[model samples]
Target: MTATDPVLRALAHPLRLRMLTLMWPGPLSAAELSRELDVSHALASQHLRRLSAVGLVELAEERDRRGGRERRYRTVHGSPLSDRRDGTPLLAGTLAHNLRERAGRRAPDSEGVTVDGELWVDPQVWQDVRGRLAALAAELHAAARPPHSPGTVPVGIGVMAFALQEEARPEGDGRPNPAGSGPG
Candidate 1:
């Protein structure tokens, strides 16, 4: 399995994402992972197995509470394909597949955000918005996380912003076409 393939597949599941976030700092035992994620040990092990199969993680022997050797998994961060220039076929296809899945979900919302976006440009305005968005993305990533609550919230926020406007049409044509615009 390629780096991108595993990264994408590992991230596809919410539980897996949580597991990854937990493991990012260091390796943890399966029981510790399950407890942290509030999942059953069997389920956590299963996810870890899937992750390991894709080369995203490696299992190691660790002594548990009773001083018995137990299996533990850790993420494999040294992936060449992760460096965009490598363009390995496996990584490319996995990335494409992952993106395609996300695209399929947004296809229905494409009319306003894609397809006809070229027509909506008031070139200057789009540039300004794009700059602001880029700044926001940087700042957001740099922001600190909120304090954890006693229980997890399933709430998810998806922000989609784009410009849409009516195109200047020929005389007597009543059709209103949407134009889309964004930063280059």
Candidate 2:
């Protein structure tokens, strides 16, 4: 999705991102969301309505409770759009917020995974590797079913691959390197 898309812009907010994360595992009412996020019901409802407007979330079910019908909302899509354009900064901020939240909760490294590596390969090989990584991500996302029992929490998974740019060095530099020197 383009950066100008309303849906993408709407999702760039930190509050909305947290709301989506809270609702990822299942449906939650506006009141419930407010209670969880420590916000007013009206404020929570406003954000929920905004999310609904873009079709990211939907009214899943309404039940009669205490002489009134309570509406529950659920996320319709669990994965981020792959066609994002010019939204990297927003996405990176959201991810950082998420990571910070998890860290605040003292989440162990075992609860999540991070992969970082650099490889030199032919362009075609890199393309194939990227495709395989995308396929694996899709497969894992598809296999993510709702929590079946207590003690289970929703897990967020993200995959990104890009070629790194080489740093340029000054030509005919006479300064000696402090950290060390020639590979030879």
Candidate 3:
């Protein structure tokens, strides 16, 4: 498979996203992921295997409490998964729809949270906006490699950057604003 194909496939499953979130803090074993994500150990192992197959995760030999070698997985740098591959858009939309549906089923009186956001931009400005963001990112990467100066802050940042092309919606649709939504 090409570079982006694995990313698309790795992210195609909801369980994989949960796995990534679990590993965001640090490397985790299949047992830990299963417990944290509420998945069976076998299921967690399968997910980790798939992610490793795509190079999105690296498995290291680590000792379990029993002192036997067990596999631990960590996320690869720079999103070993690709966003430019085919089927990514559809997969993303499906995941969004499922999450929204799940949120909508909760009782209003319950202390539930919902995340929603949308961005509306003029078609003519889209390309220019994206190009400017890319240029800025490249500049940051170039600067990040240089030696730190006095009063500089060294930090690890996790960034999720993406754009959405609006799909046609029927009149009187009642979805929340796209450009400025936050976790509830």
Candidate 4:
């Protein structure tokens, strides 16, 4: 989650992000990921190894299954996007890709929140909102259940927020001026 080169590289793929989410609630073997994501077993194993190599996932268990050993991995649960923007650019593209995929699979009768924006706010207000966003994300992850559990509905959520640098304006306009804002 420190945004090291390997970690960023491993996360650049959209499928890896989805795999981490699937494994968040519980450990899952490569075969399970393949079945859930509709990818080949080899493809799932390749991505899982990349995730494991970066320490984003760890082997939680290994057991015999149909005469072969099955290894299950679980997410490490660090704040990948909150690691201080080291690889935010690359991660942003990955997020966009995954978001599109999720949107396609969205349940027709379900209402969901989807918003995006860029604006300036008071420093204290920004801080408060950021903390709340992080809390909500953690709560969702903690509430997650294994895939397709009865009485649980599948959901997709993506959030990204960061402070932007102020651009230099004319010397005469050095006074602080808030940027435009709208509901999102």
Candidate 5:
């Protein structure tokens, strides 16, 4: 998918992102999502419909309970970020929004840890690190929930790396070397 795809645009919102995360593990009905997210049933259904419109989610099942049919929604696996060429910016923006929200609610030492540092390494090393990080993220996404638990909390993990550029040189050279090296 391209950056301008409706799916990417639809997934860019905070509430929609939260819904997708909640549905990652399995199928969830609008009522279940509403309870989990503390939202109204109509609001949850609206967002689910939006997600379904973009093909990011699908109707997994429908069951009759209490004289009404409950519609369950599940994320369309292998479709969310399958086209990486256009997903980076969207994912980065989402990550930044999530980080900002989390930071506003708690201190750095409260519930989660944040790591930030700069590293200068060979291109191959950088690629290896990126691959490893991608694997870890996939593992986290596919992880199974613990059965018979009270409730589950959502966590965000992010990894970013990019090359630094060199400073520009003077156009017309009559000036002394910045490093104080003469024409030796």
Candidate 6:
């Protein structure tokens, strides 16, 4: 997916990603989103329109309020993904922004987990790990609750794993070191 991918373009913003998560469990009107996200009504509405335009969200309901119509929108899927390899960079940037914001809100005294890896692994191992990671993400989305609900804790998880192209060794760089003739 390139800039031409509407879903990618719509969700390229941090706020739009946040809005999508907020709507995963249920529908929310623009005004409600504004209050929950601490943004102006117009801004929330504009983002909602963008999401809807891309088919990432659909109008769930509409009602008359204060002589004006109020529209509620829900995500098309609990976990939204265009699943295009070309869109990785945009999604990565969104995830990075989200992680930074969530990290700042972390509770210093509370336990948290963070890990990074760039290792070479067997193909089967990589496949199994990828499947488990995806399942865990789906499970989390399934268990999501409305924002700030009682007895629920807010947690953030970001996963980015992909196989990189094998780098070509420079001429003669692969030769074994002569210094390894004997164990030290």
lDDT of each: 0.55, 0.74, 0.62, 0.88, 0.74, 0.84
Q: List candidate 6 stretches off by more than 4 Å.
A: 1-3, 78-83, 174-184
Q: Write candidate 2's Cα lDDT for 1-184 as tens digits.
A: 4237788877787788778767766788998889888899999999999999998899999999789999999888656556465577677777677766656765465556667688666779988987898888777655544444365655655455676565555755765433433521
Cα lDDT of model 1 by residue, 11-113, tens digit: 5565664555455435777787888767899999899888777776776556656767677776664432323343334344554554454465563434433
Q: Give the lowest summed-lDDT range of ten residues in model 3.
A: 152-161
RMSD of 5: 5.3
Which 10 consecutive residues of model 1 have the lowest summed lDDT? Answer: 152-161
Query: Which residue pairs clash within candidate 6?
Result: none
TM-score of 3: 0.54
- Of 3 and 4, which scores higher on lDDT? 4
Query: Which candidate order results from sorting by TM-score in descending order?
Result: 4, 6, 5, 2, 3, 1
Local accuracy of candidate 5 as per-residue lDDT tens digits, 77-165: 76465435565777678868877875675645556667887765677998898788778777988884522235755466545545555
Which regions of candidate 4 fall more than 4 Å away from where they truly are? 1-4, 168-184
Output the worst ten-in-a-row residue range by lDDT, candidate 2. 175-184
Runs off by more than 4 Å, candidate 2: 1-3, 108-111, 117-121, 132-158, 163-184
* Candidate number of the best lDDT: 4
Reference-based TM-score, model 5: 0.73
Per-residue lDDT tens digits for candidate 6, residues 90-151, read: 88999899999999989889898788877877889999988888898889989988888999
- Model 3 residue 163 lDDT? 71
Clashing pairs in 5: none
